[model samples]
Target: MQAPERIMSCERPDSEEFCYFLAKDYFRFVLDGSESQPAANNVVETLRRSGSSLDRSGRELEHCINKLNLSSIEEVERVLPSLMREIYSDGIDNWGRIVTLYAFCGVLVSNLKKKGVPERELIEGVAQCLAQYTWTHKAAWIKENGGWEKGFVEHFQEKKNSHFYTKIAAFTGIVAAFSFVIYQH
Candidate 1:
């Protein structure tokens, strides 16, 4: 089957917000059941055609959903860590890709919860992994600027540094909030 055309634009490919929106739209499309094919099948086909590392992860995730019956919490527990590790280990240097993966995980976790899966452990594990990665990246930026102590002092003093980190935090918060809303509806 031919993959559906990408509906969202990615002009700001480096922006976390852009990637999060793209992931949200993609998940919404897949989960809404607006297409003739199964959502997992369509997602896999689309990702297989996109040829990006993020898409590759999506394809693998679709396969995992199909193969392991993700509706089951036990199956998710067995599969999620390795899937997360694969995405993390793929050397995806782009923040957009990382954000996309983070959003995808959020959507997946939310969906599983909606399906009545007890997912405290799964949510905590995924959140911890993503949070650690984000912290590591931010720490590197702080180190490059001077060091954590100096950076923290300067971050409050400098409007630019404060604004940058605030934007990052806001984007993360927005994605989390959006995912919760999506799951609720």
Candidate 2:
């Protein structure tokens, strides 16, 4: 499940390629009953191949997961609120970031579901977070700037543009992975 090379870039805080690769890798790990160490190593390799740094948000997620020492629904319930807060408050303000959050949540929920854990609460929590911080604000911002298509086009075409398609690819990859996870549930 290799992402296209051209989709890799360092500028985006949550690279779409990285998010998709991480979620896909994690989902596979869960399905395969593999240990977390292999998944983490794969994530590092994927990040390197994508030419994306593991930014603060990614590191924070790793730290939260490691510190919690749980892989069940309890872990998702305990860590998600703080994770969402940090991602929204201090992370990049972009569609990719929002999509990354959605993808991450989707992966967690899917994993829980596969483990036969009741996932309604976690799913609702994710929905609430997205409704409050992501979809609502993103919709308003897009409306204020025109619609999504126009807004994104204009935003990417502005001065100092670099790796515009890479950003779009990342966004697309995240959305695709998010959809896949959601479908699995």
For each candidate, the alpha-carbon lDDT, in order, equals: 0.43, 0.43
Worst 10 residues of 1 by lDDT: 42-51
Estimate the lDDT of model 1: 0.43
Q: Model 2, range 1-185, lDDT digits (tens) per residue?
A: 33352235212313333334444443443334434344234223332222222122243333333444445665555555555555454333564454355445544555466566655554544445444444434555545654433544344345123544544544544444434433432
Task: Give the poorly placed runs of model 1, Cα more than 4 Å off.
Answer: 1-68, 71-78, 88-90, 119-122, 133-185
TM-score of predicted model 2? 0.39
Clashing pairs in 2: none
Highest-scoring model, TM-score: 2
